[model samples]
Structure formats: structure tokens, C-alpha cells
Target: MIIENFSSEKRENKLNQLSAEFVVAGGGIAGVCAAITAARKGVKTILIQDRPVLGGNASSEVRLWVLGATSHMGNNNRWSREGGVMDEILIENLYKNREGNAVIFDTILLDKVMQEENITLMLNTAVSAVQKADEKSIEAVWAFNSQNSTHYKIDAPLFCDATGDGLVAFQAGAPFRIGAEAKEEFGELFAPDEAYGHLLGHSMYFYSKKTDEPVKYKAPSYALKEIEKIPRFRVIRKEHKGCNFWWFEYGGRRDTIHETEEIKYELWKVIYGVWDYIKNSGNFEDVDNMTLEWVGNVPGKRESRRFEGLYMMKQQDVIGQTEFEDAVAHGGWALDLHPADGVYSELSGCTQWHSKGVYHIPYRSFVSKGIDNLLLAGRIISASHVAFGSTRVMATCGVGAQAVGMAAAVCKELGVQPADLMEVTNLKKLQNELNLTGQSIPNIPIRPESNLLTQARVTASSALTLSTIPFDGKWKKLNVSSAQLLPFEANTAYAFKVQVNASEKTTLEVQLRKSHNDKNYSPEVILESQVIEVGAGEQTVDFKFESSVADQQYAFVTFMANPALEIKCSEKRITGVLSVFNGENDKVSNKGKQTPPQGIGVDEFEFWIPERRPEGENIAMEISPAIEAFDVSNIGNGFVRPWGTANAWVADLSDTKPTLKMEWDSEQPLSEIRLFLDTDYDHALESVQFGHPEEVIPFCLQNYTIKDLNGQVLFQQSDNYQTINAFKFEEGFSTKGLLIETEHPSSDVPAAIFEVVCL
Candidate 1:
């Protein structure tokens, strides 16, 4: 005989009361990442989403491409990728939905959330009511699920508002601001001179398909009758579809939160009008078979109410590239300011200004200034309008989400509020925990409390290697004795090697110049030069320079075009280190066809020219600077920030047997051995836009072996592509030293690592 816990009336009412350490609102990637982080940290967490599917803008309902540090479309962004849970999602997506299907992506997010047993996820449940525990704390949230006709009252100690519109914050009475701030407010340069209540606006998207048979489109009754009256409507061509129709926006003057429904209808009307014009207009061809495949009813919004936090990100901090001690996340996207009038503004789609390097996002931005338990994530976090323009990107918001989630765990564990975690010691613990979990916070190394790796002396296989290349026995001359003019963008110091062709045994004087702007790609300041002489045919010349023009964003090498010189160029483009000019139409495939090699799109400039375009990964330039700025000990130093000079260990490919060894001063007690491999310390595991435009570079050590000092094999992994490597002994062991042998991936790449922890 069994006894029932609930009464018949209670069971009939379908009321459920649940409790957890954290309650997350919104099922977008931000909320999902936050919930996953907390759940993985052993905190009892519950995630609530108003929609059935997760991933707010990236969901099937509205497929906004994940654009982050790549700055939407690569405005000279280097070593950019949002790692941690965001990268984990991307990797899983690549493995399962390599084609980037929206539905598959939805399932992937769901699968990840479901995998964490500590998290209780409620779908299609809207949080309608909140019960305040006190003036600053939320005791419980009452939500309703119409699908199941049930009411859920979730009681939690901490809460996160990952909702794009900041609904949770609004309902909780957390102080927030709507619309743009005046330039005088935060002394912002990008802000409007006068304050305006107008917002960026709402946008809907549609996709069209080409069927074999003819298809027709009937304009919606509410579609704008005189589409020509609208600004920028004439620019719409039939070819524009899906994410391409980002300009179909509306509702700038109206309250985006209160009048969201009205904005949605307005954007829909504009979309239909644009679609009708594309199909009916005589100017558009190849529309005989095109039909609307999918249209977004749910508008993806840009800005709404932003809750105030302990610290607000300002424009100066972003563009100035301030090195903050509390930077928990980073963004490299330009300060993209769109007109408040949105779709109807007679201005360029948006104005953008690039940053010198990736800008930092502080943890204080997520902590609520007033609400004790409330934390802000995603677009709703505290930031000026100018800074919001960059921070609002999906990938950056995702990074903030992980940060806030990890902080929430610390709050629950320490029995403290979100605001209390900002103290130095407390923050260090949280920061170290985040780094241990693969989240990168710039400059800040994981605390040196109990790390044993710092105790071991670290040495690597090869310390120096010169860049070398073997050509396919082909060369082209620039009408004068010259070396191929290879262009690149380098934010920091770099070493360069160029392949050149010379006639009559001439010496080449390489003059390095930095570009003044994106347009007119010609260099401004004449920095330095290196002389390399080559014999008649094809030859590779190495130019090792000490002084680097690290201040500029653009750099190019022009070989003095003499009659005795021939310049050879390659197609492959390197990040900040190398790439050939894009405007070369004379590119010939190795098959001797008229196919041009894929190169950088310097479409705006006509200056830089390529010689005979070599196909494949041929940047025609290689740079391997001395890693003296970094040492082997930098790996276990616990500073996990990508690209931070002190955060990684780089081995030169020059050595015959490239290896890394860790020797203890004496026989040390070692229970576990952890190895971190350098998979290109700067290039993160994050990608924005459609799927992954790039992959984990081949810089990752492909083959490696680990041995003890007594010549004993402990562990061996031959196929390695991941950035982090960890190993734990079942019991415990005492050893004097450890040996890490790194073999050449092919004969060019060397071994590299970020951190190695010994426990």
C-alpha cells in the first residue's frame, strides 16, 4: 500500500512549487549558457523560457547569425572567438549540424540543457508574477504554462535576466533605462548630442526559394501601397533574402517594450511590401520560380530597457581598449551606431568605428546596482548606447552569460548576493573558477592558491624557427625586379618572411608601410626595410626584423620594382600576419585555368596587386616572432586569456625534436598530470556568423607523447585538436620530472600550450 503526497484538489489544480539555487529567465543562448554554467558548477538551477524552443535570436523563429568578435564581417579582427559554453555549443553544432540547420541548432541547445541533470528547464512557460522576498531580493517567481494548464512557483536564491528586453528586471523593479542616453550623460562620443527616447527598432526576416515551376507572390492587404515612398526601399533587389534583409526594420519612436506587437505588425508590413516589390517589379529577373519559403513573425529586436549594474561600460573604455583588472569577457566588434529612425533613416545602414584590439567586459557590468540577487546578462546589461552597439552582439552576450552564471554559483556557494562577489578575494575565486572551466578573462591569471604546475620548471622542445616554404616551381614578375607585395594587419609585434623572385641577381629593398585607412590601401608611414638578394628563378628569402610597427592596423611590403625582379604571390590569407591583394582577376588555378585564388576582399582599394595568384593556403608571408615575451612557465601560470603575451607557451618549430619538460626541484608528490596544448593561443574557439567560417588551425600539436624522467611512458595522444588537455592518476604517484615530446605536425608547425596544471 502506497500513500499519496498530494491532495486531490491540489492535484486537480495542477500547481507545482519548485526550488533551486538559481532561476534563469529567457531561453536564449545567454540564458541557456548561464543556466548550464551554474548547473555544471553543481548548483541546483532552473531555466524558464517563454517559447518552446531555446536560442532567442538564433532560434528557428528568428535566425539571427551569431556575430561576435569577428565583428560581423572581419574588420581586421585577429585571434577572435568566444570560447567556454559558447564554443562548446558551436563545436556540438559543427559535429551534428555542420550544414547549420536552424531546427538542428534548436535541438542541440535543448540537448545541452537537458544533459545537465542539476538544471530543471521549463519550456513554454512565461513568468507572469514575482513575489519579493524583500526590497532587494526575489523570493519566488510564479509562471504559467498554458500548454499544460499549470502554474509553477519557482523559489530560488539568485536570478538572471537574460531576457533580451529585460522583462525580469522590469518586473523585479530593478532600475533600468530605456532608449539612448545623451552624449552629456556618460561623456560618450558616439552618443547623440541630445537625448532621444527613440530606440534602434525591430527587424523581421524572410527567406525565398527557387522552385522549378513558376511561383507568384500576392501582396498582403496591409503592405505599403507606395513602397517607393519609403527610404532605401529602391535598394531592395529580388536577390535579397534571409539575413540579407536586415534593413527591414520599424518602430524607433514607439516604446519597443510596450508597443512590441505594433512594431511586429509594422515590420511585417514592410517585409511584405519589399517582397511584393521584388516579385512584381519588372527590374528583377529570375523570379519566375522564386517563392517565399519562411518569414519571421517574431521580430528580432536590437535595444530595449537596459538594467543598471554596479559598473556601466562606456564608449571610451571600449574604443580606448582599456586594460581592466576585472575584465571577465571581451568584444572586438566595431561601435556600430544605426540611426534611430531605423528602416526609414536616409543615412548609411550604420556607422562603424574599429577598436585597436578586443575590448574588455567587466564582471561589474553584470551585477545589479540595486537588486541584491538579480544579475543582468546579454543585451540588458548596464552599458552606454555607444558601448551597447558592440556588446549587443550574440557572442559577446553569451560570454557575459557564462560570467554571470559562474558568479551566481559563487553567490549560492558563499551565501552572498550578486553584488558581494565583486570583492577582490571573492572575485579572484570566481575568476579562477571561471578560468578552470575554460572561460577567458583578459590579463587576470587564475589565483595561485593551490596550483602545483607553478612549482615545476618548464622547458620546451624548440625555441626558434625561421619561416620556410617550398613553391610549385612557378613565378611571376611585376614588370620590374620585385618581390610580391603582401599585405597584412598586425596589432602587436610580429616577425615576417617573404618569398621573392629576382632577375639578374638583384638585391631587394623591402619598404614597410602602414595603411592610413581601409580605403586607399596604401601605407602611410615608411617604417623600415630589409635587403634580401635572390638569383634568377624562384627563391624564398627570410627577413628577420627587430623593430615592428605594432601601433597600426594595416601594413604592406613593396619591393622596389626593378626590371630584374619578379614577385610571386599566394592565395591564402592569414589573420593579421599575411594575405594577398584581392582585386587580381588574372589569378590562375594550378590546373592552368582562369580560376582566381581566394584572397582578401580589398574591394575598396586598387593599389595592392597580386602577381600570379598561387592557389591553396599560400599567404606568401610568414611571421614567427621570438616568444620571449612568453615562457614555458606561462602555461601553468594560470593566466588563461587568449593572446595575452603572458598566458601561453610557444615552442619553435626549428628544433629537431620539439619537446616540453617539467622538472620538479626534488622528488615531488604528484597525484595527477595535466597538459595544455597550444592550439594557437590567440585564435579562440569561438566563431560568429553562419556556422564556423574558420576551423581550429593546424597549429595544434597533432602528435605528442608524455613520459616520466626515468624514461617511462605515461600517456600518449596522437590526434589532438583541442586547446585544453588534462590527465588524472587514479591514486597518486611521486615523480621527479615529466617529459612532453611534441612531434612536427608536418615539418612546419611547432608545439604550443596555454596552461598545464599538476595536482
Candidate 2:
């Protein structure tokens, strides 16, 4: 061992200075998406995280499931799963870790960030100080890593604060609000009063495992022994663990940021106390073999400081379903708020108010109002408290941050401030760029001027004429009302014939319904009704509706609740086709129907949700005239996902080698081609806990090949399982005609694609 001389001066940590085109703080889903999107756009980026791993609340450290607009498929937002980089991550996780192992999720996030060569990732680093260049611009940021005892000075032209708590915005003197605004502030009738609590709180989770041998548990001295104090303690059972205790929360009344430690301790007291009750109170069975597996140290935070931006989203913006011209993202989770007293409160754990459909999130809400170089993201972006209730979920946050990331890239390219992109000329550019990546803005189709395919003639080898879905699957009981969503081409009336078995003589009521707003799945408008006379035993019910649809839309062939009958289901599953049931999903607080209080400023509608696969089979029916919307011409319609109608080109199931051909008058130079296929956007790919049934969505294309005029293969991919498959060819080639051959993922499902673009 070598001896060291004593130093007179105080020891200083090592200092380092780094620079990039863009900088992002926090490594949650929002921050990860932001940095990944920016880096993918060729912007030199730096991503700093205070933790060792990414995913923030969704990390193994916190263990909260990743959910957003889809809301566990428990709400009326059908086919509303987030897209772009957020979709990429969720789908990748579903493919690789459908079991939802939290540790595996952590690896996926890390792998994605590490794969980006443009991203400089700094883990276990915290932003401790801000250096402003002027009154409204950030010069640099000062962050320190305790793990290495190093201080860093990171400089970038643009900075995004996705740190949930708005640390960067807070330090830069940006305007922000901490608690709920009064009802009069935004005309939000859903705003909470003082007694109802203003801010959402923090939560912690723990996992328990059962062993063959008996296991014993010992409670610490600080454990909460008085379990009866918690009002919902009786709801806990031996089978429940981890996210089952999402309501085990605290610290809404206290400072969520500064008192996080105190809140964590309180959560610990509750967790150990509950485990003690299950192990020692003699209230649960087979608990002697159960032992605590993992407990989250850092609490999963819900709400904190919300930064002010160019425009703040209010309750009306969400409830009214406003479509902003500068719409960059969407939100559909209910306006969910919790009681201030948390677990101790006698009131319900949460109050969720849903809208009629998913609402647009404007780009104005992402740019800071004061700071020119600063961009806001995640739950901290501008929004009133009542609106924050819907936008604060992790998946919504991820997509919002993705929009912000793309905006930062555009700002860098145009040499302008973040707010400057709001102009009509610039806003469309941003929206088009996002759409190119398969991020859909509701009601906004890709511009014809931006896609070259719109000018070419598109034709398919064979298109599907869907007249029937044979009754080769299961016979589902009519425990609740069920409906089959059928896409109609235009103002056409269609008749349906369905097979059903009745236990007793009963009149089966059939109604044709549609959404008042064509784009939404909420069926509120009844077009026609028929009460059919049926006798006991299996029989066919014929429904003929004379009224024609006003436009091309999905009409719900609904069978009212009649417990005496069982309807047949089809084994075949197709893209943009589903069977929904008006039922309750207790996990998401949908009690069959939503009947809110008179003055809550919300809609009352029945929740029609599709069951998870292996159970959500399509209803077997025969149509008089087949729907012809699945034509080759649909490939250039500009819409990427199903909108008001089935905006997809589906080949006949018998066509084993489905081919699409595109030809131009003369030779055209091309370098890139993007294929937007069907990946069942309706399924909510929750990051953890809730395991998925299939590794790959059945509608996705498994293999495909692109050919030139000479019949030479230009590009080919096998085992493809994503919604978007983009291929780029260096040293571009000239082709007068292009042909695409696709293989269906399975025999029962037909080959389908939404859009194809050549650049």
C-alpha cells in the first residue's frame, strides 16, 4: 500500500463539459421517447437520468404498468393505442417480454437508447443547476453524478424538460402551477374543491412469491401494525400482489417533491403492515408459503409541477374533444383524480370521467411560454389540473414527448424557436413528419402533396369481398348485449343473417347503431331496429334495415341482451374487425355503463369493449351485399389507420400470394419506400403485469418482397411483426413499375395494409 500526503484544500469532484444539438433531462418513458426520436432524426442528443436504469415509473424500481389512451382496453377508445417510437417500444416489449418481467422491460429501454449512435446517455446523473444564457434561453446545464463523484456541464441549443417534476423549467424561472385551479379559472366543472384534494399523489408497489416450502415473515419495528386503519384493507387477498395494491398510496396533502422520502417511508409502513397481516393475522390461506419478492424503494409519482406553455389544455379541451389545428398527440384516459388523504380516505381511490372519444393534444402545450430554448414534455407540460388528470398517464406522456422531440429537430433545421413551428406552413411540416413515422393525428390524413404514391395507379391482385364469417368457432352466451362492427363502403344499406340458439321462446331484438361522430367507436345513434320472433332451439335471425348510412362508416349490428340465446362466433379474425360487448371491466372502473352526476360536464355512455384474444372472436354473420371498401385504391387514401371506415386494402383469404402493383407513366427515381401494415392498433400493450396472449398481432404481415419492373427483387423481409416497415435504398434506382408481394401472418387472416409511400 502506498501512503498519500494530506491535502490542505478541500477535495473537488472531477468536472467535464459536453455539448450536443439537443439535451433532455429525465429517463422516464417520456424522456426516452424524446431523446430517441430526436437522435433518430440526426440531432446530436444527450439523455441524462438520475437512476441507474430507464423507464422511470415503469421501471422495475417503481413497477407501475405502462397505460395510456387505450386504458387497459377498458374504455371506449377503440384502436387508440399510441404510435411512433412509443409504439415501437411497446410492441418490442410485447414481442420479447410478454410475460412482463420488469427486469426485462428495463433491458429493452436501455437497449433502445444504447442503439442510437447520436445519443449520449448519462445514467445516475442528476441536473443540479441551470445556466441561462439570457432571460429566455438556456446556455448550459450543470448536473452531477454521485456514483462517480463527477460534475458535468452539458450545452445544447434546445433543452427538453421531461423530468415529471419540471426541474429544468423550475430552475429556469418558467411559469408553473402546483395545485388545482378553481372551477372558474378554466370553466372546468370537474375541478376539485379544497375538501376533495387538488393534487394527485404518489404510489409504491411490492411483489410476493409462493414457495413449496413454508416461509416466515418478520415485521420491522417501524412497520404499521394497525392494518385496520386503512379503509380498504379487507379488499386485499392472498392472490393479490404488486399492482393489485396500486391504491396503496400517500402524500397528496404534503409536498410531493420535497417530502418524497417521507412518503416512501409511509408507503413502506403500509406494505410491511399489509404483508404482516397476510402472514400473521390468520386472514389468508396458504400464505405460510408466501414471501416478499421485491419492494419498490422509489415511489411512482403521479402529479407535481405543471409548466405553463403557449397554450394550456383545460377540462373542456378534453371533455369537448377539441381538434386543434396544431394537434401533435392524443389523450383518452379518463380525467382521473384521487383523494388527498390517499389510502386513509373513505372516498373511492379515484374519480375517472371519460370523454366521447380521444381528444387532440395541441403542439402549443409543449413549448414553454417564457423560455425560448426550453421545451416542455411529460406530465409537466402545460395543462390545467383537471386536464392533467387525463394527460398524466405514461403512454400519453411518451407520445407527447415524441412530438416535442420531432419539434426540436424541426426547430434545429429551420433555425427558429420552438414556438415558431406553430405557423400553418411550419405546423403541417411537423405533422407530416410525424405521420411519416406512423404517428396518427385524429382526423388528419397524410397530405397528398407529400406522398408520391397518390399520383400513381394502385391495383391489387384480388380484394376481399367479405360476405360471411362462418360459424366455425364458439357459441357465446348473450349474458350482455353484443355487437359486430361491420364496415360499409358508402351510403349503402346492408342486411345481416346470424345463427343463434335459444333455450326458450323469446323475441330477439336487433338494432343497427353507429357513432354520431363517424370516427368514434361509441355507438350512440340508432339507425334501425327489428324485433324478431324466435322459438326454442337453433335458428337463423334475419335483420333487414332499409335506412342507408349517411356516409362510409362502421355500423354496429347490435343484438340486445337476451340471456335465453347464444350467438355463434367466427374462428377467422380480420384486420379492422371486432366484436364488442357492453360490459364492465372492474379494473378500470367501468360499471357496464357510465352515468355521471348531472353537473360533472361529462358524457354518459355504455362501454363497448372487445375481449382479449382467444376470447374476443368475431360474430359469425352473412351480409346480403359484400363490403367493397378493401380495394387497391385505398392504399393511397393517406389515412394510415382505420378512421371512419376500414381504410385498408385487404386481399381475399384464398389468395396465398397477395400482390399490389403500382405503375407510373414514366420512370421515377426512388430511394425510400414505407409500408404501413395492420398491427391491431386496438390492443393496449401494457408494459408490465398484464401479460399478452399473442407474441405477434395476427393482422401483421409475416413476410414480404418488393420487385422492380424487370422482376428483380429490390427488398425483402421475413418475420416482420411491426405496424410500419420502412426500407431505404442507397444510390437510388429508377423504376417505372413496382410490385409488392405479401404473405399473411396466418391462413385464417387476410393480407392487409393501410398505406404505402414512395420517396
Candidate 3:
């Protein structure tokens, strides 16, 4: 043997090197969405994924359901579904994979990436080495492709750690924290008193099918020995399979990363033993034909490592519905947190509390605080343990990913890092851009510089004006009891006015009701009914109510019903002012308590009709305007809340041909026009896990035609789809004004423009 104990030549390992503008790690929903957004904007993007297929937990291997603002039908999440890419993905699944097949879902995700020409997808590749230029920036990443046994050296100017565990951030020396933070650290009510290195845990689920013949089962050696030791195992049924048993989770108290394989083994035992109980325990009802079709080999994880960012979400932010100026996303899920012991815990599966509505998520939560070149999305973003319980869902994470991707593209254009996005002026520009892409940021208004409606004077055929806000003073049909909402600032004087028309002689009683508590939606406090006598035709009443409303309070002016009284319907949609406690035929279910379908329909299209009339058609009552003439600032003052009732100008429904007309003081550069047609934004976009609803919306504008002032037809569309209508021309024309003639299926309904945006 030679003294040196080595060959003269040193071994050299060959590696494949590639360059890109942006490199995203992980192929989960967040990574997939981020890569898609950047690639579509012409960013040279590289997506490295450890799995063979896309969609981390949502893939066929893990079989976890894709849940977001809908919260899987819990938490009274009406109109809370996510928009943008998430909306497209859910609609696609409903159309293509109606049966909820996981295999077909994988193809749908793959198809999305393939459609983007600029995205370089490398699957079955695990990132192993991180090369840093200095202490602050990551220069390159080396990932080994397991499928082909090749090492890839990927170099990019900017990087996104969308991996759920924050792998790239950890390896790049980025500042981050693992496990839980102490209650005092963030002042989070849901946080633990003492900080612990524990996680929310990993979960696995199984699927079952029915068979004609009885199926037999043999327990594997690693199967859980004691059936009595497992919790929530009796829930297995013939119709019950995936997502129904998210409680079948474990491995939280142990190291979720280093011990992942061991945790997977433990989950398998629990899954098989649970199925055995359903099949052979003899306590089951009709299970002779029931058999396990598939069991997840890989456990789906909920939480792992969270990286530090400019802002960390706290429990107070969620419970208080804190408004952030730089908000880019929202979450409506309840403050859901689990015991660290997971399935083995003696306590219940989880503790949950709902909020008033959706809470805002600021843009500051997307970038790294210390690192210049790194950004993060997905479950690994900066947030307290309790806050993550709500934001960790796939739909919410996808929105954060979209924000990060767009920010990356903007950074490239501006020649800056992720930190520069926090500038006040730049943040507003980003918000404006996001609104254009159909992302909703509650309470934020579109700036006037780009808002076309703000620059043009608008006039409608007829608008049933009420208060400064639309729909707050409207009353309508089968007046079992109608309520008008009064929004007032503290210490400000408010005049409550009511105009009533009586078909037959009846008395109108008005009650100012106050909200009881958080749990119940009932406005129980009757602040004394101010009654008034009304004759046939019309009568007006005015009252100066007691000034006790605190800041941001909404008082319901409840008007007790009189069968003899009928309010005429207004052509313009009045949003929420047409609140009726109950119709003569409306009844609740006999079983569980049901929040009556939010929009206009459940079994019938009742939402389209605001109020019921005893002898005639349903219509909204006309409210005298604060100003005599229509204002240009009326439509696009920017707030599009109250869902269906945003400030809209109504065209004359009775005119031979009703048209929406806009005029400007000077020639305005107009290439594109967007119309916010009236559709039920109050109702949600369903996943179709339940039965599908009516495919066509009756209240929305059905057909429309557009042309210049000269009457030359520019564009036209029929069999119109969706609540938001857009018309675009590449070769734009300079014009002072354009006429929009909308055709409706029914003369009773006219085109109501909530926001008419042009560019």
C-alpha cells in the first residue's frame, strides 16, 4: 500500500448548471402558483420539486383536500372563496374531476405548468446544497435529480422558498424560528404560556369503496395492536373517506423532519387498524361489502418551520379583524388550533373560534427580513403558531404566493430587492395592480389616477338613491318585517327617514335593534318601536334616534311587517337594505341549524327578488338623492363591499332602449373597458363536493353591445357569462365618450354598473 493511501488524480464530480431570473423550490400549491404568475409575466423561472408530480399535500400521494376561505363548509364563510389562480383551479376541478379523483387532479396541476412557456419544471429533484455570495444573499442552489441521478446547479438573482418546511431559507443562513413562540413574545391570546418546540403535526387519510362480496383483512405486523388506544376510529363509514378524517393525525411531539419516516410508519398502523375496526369489529351497520381501496403512503404535514419576515401575524390581528394599509390578501377561517399531542392527545381534536368576517393579511408578511434576495410564501411565512392555523390553508397560501411572484417580477423591473416593496408609494401601486388582476382587498379603494369612472361624468336612466351609501335605505316584498341598516360614526348626528306606501291601510312600526353578542347573529335589543300611521299610496316619517352608536357600529332599523303595506321595487340593486326576517313560506330545516342560503336562492331563485308584494311584483323602493343630479364619483369611489350592493348607477328600465353613457371633459385614452355586472357575490363559488347550484345567474346582465359615439360597432358579445364583464382592443382609439347598450332577459331588471373601469 502507498504511504499517501490515495490515487494521484483527485476525483471530479460533473454537475449540470443552469441560470434563471427566478428559482422557486417546492411544487406545492404555493410554488406552483408563484412560478405560474412570474412565468406568465415573462420571468425566466425555474421550479424545482422533490416529488414526481405537482401539488404537495393535495397530490394523489397525500390526498388532502384543497381548502381555503370556504373552510370546508364551516364558519359561516359566505362569499369568502379565494380569487385569481385559486378560483381558476377550483372551477377546473369541478369541470374536469367531478368525482374528486386524485389522479386526474394531478394532471390538471401538471397541465397548468405546461401551459406556461417560460417555466422550467424539474420534478423529482431535491435541493441539497446552497451557495451564498456573502452573508446576505444566496448565489446558487444544487439539487440532485433522483429520477436520472444527475446533480443540477441552479443560479438565479432572486429565490422563493415556497417549500412548506422552509428548507432553502434554513440552508441559506436566513433567520427563522422553529416550534411555538411564547405568549408574551407576540401578545397572542391563543399562544402557549411557555414556548415549546412542538408542531401541529402530520396527518394521513384513506379511501374506501363498496363491493358486492365480503372482503377480508389481515393486520400487518406494524399495525396498532390496541384498538381501544386509538381515538375517533368509529367514524369510518361507507360514504365517508377522504378529508372526513383529518383527525387521523400524529407525530407532533417528535421531530417532524428527522423523524418523518418513523411518523409515517406510525400513521400507517393507525390507518389500517381504523379500517379493521370498521370491517371486522362487528359494531358496524352495513360493512360486509366495504373495503379499503387506498391508504396514503406519505403523511400530509400541517406545520414545520416558519421564517422571520417584516411582519408577524398575531392572534389579535385575526380576532379583531385588524385592517392593514398594505393588505394584499384575506382569510376567513376560524382561529383553529390543535393540541400538540395530535391524535394521541386525550383532549378533543381542536379548539376553534370564528371572527366577525374575513381578516386582512398584509404584504409585509411575504419577504425575508434579513435576506435581500429571498422571499417566502405558503405555510412557511412569518406568523405566530395560532395565526398560521388560519393562514396555512392551500387557498390562502396560494394568494400569498401570487403576491410574492408579482413582487419578484416588479423587483426585476425596478432593479431592487424584496425589501424595497415595503415603500408606501410602491405598495399602493402593487395593490392597484392586484385589483386589476381580480384580487379583492377589503376596505382598499382603487386610486383615481387609473380609475376611468372617476374621470368621466356618468348618468343613468334611473337610480333609486337612498343614503350616501347605496341600498341602506331600500325596502321590499312580503314585508314580514324589513330592516334598514344605519352606519354612523360615533358622536355624529344621523337622521333616520322612512317612506312607506300602503296598498291597504296598515300601521308601520320601526324598531332600532342592537346586536346581542358575538356567537349569535340575532339583533335582539328592541330600542322601542317608533310606530307611525300610514294611509293608502305613500307616507313619510322622520325621527331623530338616540345618539348611542359607537364607532364602526351598524344599527338595524327593523320595520315590523304589515300585510297591507307594500314597497315598490327600485330598478337599481340596493345591496343589503332589503333585509326581511322571514317570508310567509320561508322555514328553517328540521334537523341541524342552517344559515339560509346567503344570496337569492336555496330551492328557488328568491335572492333576485329583494322583497315580496301581497298583490303585485317585487321591487325596491326609490330613495330621494342627497344631490339632485348623478355624480361621476358615484360608481368608482372604490369600495366594492356589501358584495352585491356596491355604489351603482341604474339605467332606465322602462326606456325603449336603456343604455349606460359616459362622457369626459377631454379626449381620454381608452383601450379597455371593464363592467361590473350585477351578480350574486354574496353566494360562494362552490367546490361541488355537494350538489351543484343553478348554472345561470338570473340577476346579471345577459347580453351587451358596445360602440363609439359615431355609432360604429366596436364589439359585441352574447350569452354573456360571469358577474365581471371585460372588453379589450389592442389597437386603442382616443375618444371623449362611448355608449354601452345592455340587453337583459327581463324588462324588470336593468343593467346596474357597480364600477365601470376604462384604460
* TM per candidate: 0.81, 0.99, 0.78
Error of 3 at 541 (Å): 18
lDDT of 3 by residue, 185-270 (tens): 87775677899988888999888988999878877777876777866554456577766677777888988878889889988988
Cα error, residue 253 of model 2, in Å, equals 0.2
Local distance difference test scores for all models: 0.69, 0.90, 0.68
Candidate 3 residue pairs that clash: 461-652, 476-611, 477-611, 477-612, 478-612, 569-619, 569-620, 570-620, 600-607
**Descending-lDDT candidate ranking:** 2, 1, 3
> Candidate 3, TM-score vs. the true structure?
0.78
lDDT of 3 at 254: 85
Number of the top TM-score candidate: 2
Candidate 2 TM-score, true structure as reference: 0.99
lDDT of 1: 0.69
Model 1 regions lying over 4 Å from their true place: 1-13, 448-450, 467-497, 501-526, 529-634, 637-659, 666-697, 701-721, 731-751
lDDT of 1 by residue, 208-312 (tens): 889999988899799877777578887787776767777677777888888999989988888888788878877688888999988897999888888899899
